[model samples]
Target: MDYWKSKVLPKMRLIFVKAGGKKAAAAAELVKSFDESKGEINSEFEEKKADLQPKVVEIYESVTAPVKVLIKERKKVSAIKKNSAAITKLFEDLANIEFPGAKQVSEGISKVGPALLSSPIFATFEKIAKLLPVVVEETPKEAPAATEEKKDEAAAAEEKKEEAADEEKKEEAVEDKKEEAPAAAEEAAPAATAAAEPAAEETSAAPAPEAEPEAAAPAEAESAPATAEETPKAA
Candidate 1:
């Protein structure tokens, strides 16, 4: 029996036993805490379980109860408040009081529901109105007056635009005149010089052909004297 137990049993135990690991000590501690042989569970783990159970039960009850019915009732009350005429009438009937009408204002609210719902300002006001039982007044809003000052401002803007256009046109005309002035001066210069040439020639004296013949006769007289003097010497 010793030979079988020492040789076969130890080998059999090695075969059955899981491979020991880095986590074996932690796993053994966990096993010891759970084992009835060690006694009841650790006090800290039991206390944590007790703390979590009530929260778990609360969550379970909330998920299982009539959540849909509560949501539906809240929506119906909201709708009743939205239809203010109906609520007003309900209040009037129940309390048996003769108050001012709320039907027209209620109709206005209904007609402008989409506008009111889209506006944060109107939506917040509407929520406040729903909470309170005050009657909504439909006071008429006056159209803004067309003051003389506003009309004058519009006319002034138009006049300023016209003045700007006129100034632009005047600037263009001045530029065109500046460009044309040089061209006009170039064309007039030759005509002015040609006209001056004729005037200068007419005013100045040009020697006549008759005056040249007269001047040559005087030279003829002076040479005769010299000729006479030479002849005497030759004789």
Candidate 2:
């Protein structure tokens, strides 16, 4: 058992942890892809899980069974001691092993599993199995809604831009009409002045006719003397 703990269990823990880390990394990558693709991770996620789950589970069970056996037989195999004493005894027992790389394995187990019955790694794995799937399922649901909201905002902005452009065109048309009004009035002023000039000239010529009649009366008066002389000749 000491040899197994120092040699086989440590290697098994490495394999188990590595598989778990790979699964975690793959899941994280899938989630990132899901966000980029607007919530489209279902197929890829299932494929990756299918490929990785069996291997992870196999290694997990292999490592977990031994660790659980050790934990169950801890009191019978060795007397319970303080955490520090247990770690020290475990290292001392490892030193007796004559394997090629026994020292390194011993050191690794000491670092990873100081207390075999109460290993933190075991608890952590349990938590991962329970919680990771929940996170994977629920995290992607918000992505589509967020994407739709961004699309709506973009459409609203485009509509506002179009409306602003139309308003600018209307204002330009109004300004053009305002500018044409003065030019039209200026063109009509000359024609109006020409039409009134004839009426003004007729009013000024009326007094000249009166003066002509008065001059004709003086000529008639001078002709009366000539008429008297002619009457005497006839007699």
Candidate 3:
């Protein structure tokens, strides 16, 4: 029983795992619904595309086709037209044209678009022409670079100013030290001389005081003998 439970239970658990989890069941339901919706939408889109594809492909093919090079190309420039409804009419008119040569067809389309659209067509074409190069490869302006250079120059000028200020402070400190040196030396010299004078006077008088003490003691002894003689005469 123990072996059966241990082995069979594990095998049953593995089977349950193979059946997948609750989250997986929910995800599968969601995917099934999404796939059905996607299939329906795709079929509808394909049917629509089937109707539009031929016309769009024709336009694409005509645009891609090579044109015969003219020996002397016409330097023809169209006048600017300013109209909104005219531009839409021009696109419609160009769509109807089927030209003999590819170059002629392209030229016909360009001319027809400008003529029908008028000013709006010209403005849109100009805008697209300006945008195409910018969209593909951006051209950076030099203003930021010029500003960065100015900032660097300003920083350098400020650093030079700070260095000059530091140099002036150092010069002032040096001058102050120089001015204090003479006063310090003069003040120290008087103190030293005054201390030396006292030492010299004490040394010179020290020997004189010791010699005078011996002379003074004999004078006191002679006076004592005279005083003894005067006492005997009085008795």
Candidate 4:
């Protein structure tokens, strides 16, 4: 594990190298034992890692994205110290994932994890990385806050589109009414002129007063003509 490598192993090297006689012999024996067991350790580590990869990837995907942000901003002191409940959950989950000699590594974290700020976070990840497929940098998924902002923007744009569409409809209606006003007046003008033409034609085509007297005389003459004609008709 990374903790073993970074902390315990160095101390081991220092102590073994510093001492002489029995200590040097014991260190040699220990190295031989590790070498003999290396094959088994590696095989077990690999198997456990394969099993844990699924859960690790799941955690990486589901951890509220703060974990990724923390890892991405690990270099910054402020960012590194950002305490995320998701990261705490990550530590808890990592503690549960077993590997070859996993206890030896997580022992430090279990003791110091709750009170610790940042280093153990990285250290926990480092161990997980060795034992699981941790995708520290995949795609940066948007947080709920960011997702809501996007939704708001989309809704605003949709509202604007609806407003624009409504305005266009109103303008079209106004334009249609304007056009109809002129068309209706044009229709009415012809109808009014046609009605007036018949009246004017009747007035202008009326019989004259002179013609009326002549038409009356013929009727009167016909009525008197029978008496004068009767005298001559008797012979």
Candidate 5:
């Protein structure tokens, strides 16, 4: 009785009172009530059991008497069948036996079996079995949402990477332009110097013409003296 109160009753309670939400709240309330009133409930159950004990024993004897007789007779028969190596024949012989009250016992078991299946306890156990897979299936349902979020994050990262690459390419192009500017200036400098050299040569050659005019005036003066001296020699 103590073991049933402590162990079996809690397990029975848990089958009906699941462990989540409103059910968890109800289970907690049930546990609190059990804790507060366990002594009273146990006393009441004991009184009820005492009241019904005699009838329960009578029913138990009535149900088990035939089973006990069957077991004893089966053992005796099996012992003989084992010596003959004929277990199947023993079962066939037992099936033929129609003890006076056997029909009532078989009918009682058949009625009780269906009643147990239709009971609230069995229904609660079935419900718990059904809920078991729901908890397992919940995690997989959330997985797709997380996977989609990860895919979005990866896409954003890829976009950022592409933007960074484009910026780097633009910077490289600007740097290439900057490097080419100096090379272009250096090339233009030699061309500019080559163009100025022809102008400088033209200016120097113009001054040489003016100096030649001055030399021509000096030559004219020497020629006049030579002609005057030649005329005096002829006289």
Candidate 6:
């Protein structure tokens, strides 16, 4: 960041201030755009930086420094162009992994030649940003199980077996409770029906008094027998 601000940024401002022809004017416009976009570029770079190898980033910085020096010193255009091409080559050679995105950056630099040397570090930063997410990427993978002592292995296996047994027992208990619910409901059904029938019978018989006459007749006969005994005694 310091290098971009101190070294490359000054050069870019100079390119803009010294803008003359059409191409220079366009390049000057590009420098301003690069300056404005640096915040986004830097934020993205920071987020994905952990995946990139530091060696590659240092090498890229090295490549950018010399090109900026050559352009600042007003060295030959051919020398600046050579160093610019080297930036693209450095990334391609340093790429130790296969990835589509990194390949694209290298191919793009090969075709474009890393913009004019006087421009801001826009192309350089962008190339690094694209490569950061892919070059030497560390894919997350499940670690291998560590070796264990025979005693520990046996104990772990026993614990796993115990857990399995406990789970099976819990399942059986749940099934038993489920079965008992229906069985209890069925047992209660007969008692409820039996009690209901008696209630219905009592309700139906409550309004009827047909047995009263029979009860009265038995009492009258007892009275008559007593009367007969008294009459005999009197005679």
TM-scores across all candidates? 0.30, 0.34, 0.31, 0.30, 0.31, 0.27
Q: Each model's RMSD to truth, in Å?
A: 25.8, 19.4, 23.0, 15.4, 24.1, 19.2
| Model 4 global lDDT (CA atoms, 0 to 1) | 0.62
Is candidate 5 or 6 superior in lDDT? 6
Name every residue pair that clashes in candidate 4. Answer: none
| Candidate 3: clashing pairs of residues | 81-118, 81-119, 82-119, 86-116, 86-117, 87-117
Query: Runs in model 1 with CA error above 4 Å?
Result: 1-127, 130-143, 146-150, 200-205, 208-235
Clashing pairs in 6: none
lDDT of 5: 0.48
lDDT of 6 at 229: 87
Worst 10 residues of 6 by lDDT: 138-147
Q: Which lDDT values do the candidates have, in the order given?
A: 0.46, 0.53, 0.49, 0.62, 0.48, 0.60
User: Which is the better candidate, 1 or 6, if ranked by lDDT?
Assistant: 6
lDDT of 5 at 83: 30
For residues 1-235, could you state the per-residue lDDT of candidate 1 as single tens digits?
9999889999877765644432344344433432432222233323444453444333323431232232223333344334544333332331222111222223333443312222221222232233333345553342233466688899999999999999999999999999999999999999999999998998786765567778988899999999999999999
For residues 22-124, write the lDDT of model 6, one tens digit per residue: 4555555555665676677556556656655465445546565664444235435566456666656654754444222344445544543445523443344
lDDT of candidate 4 over 147-182, digit per residue (tens): 899999999999999999999999999999999999
What count of clashes does model 6 give? 0
Cand. 5 TM to true fold: 0.31
Task: Using TM-score as the measure, name the better of candidate 2 and candidate 6.
Answer: 2
Off by over 4 Å in 4: 1-37, 40-142, 198-235
137, model 6: CA deviation in Å?
A: 28
lDDT of 3 at 226: 99
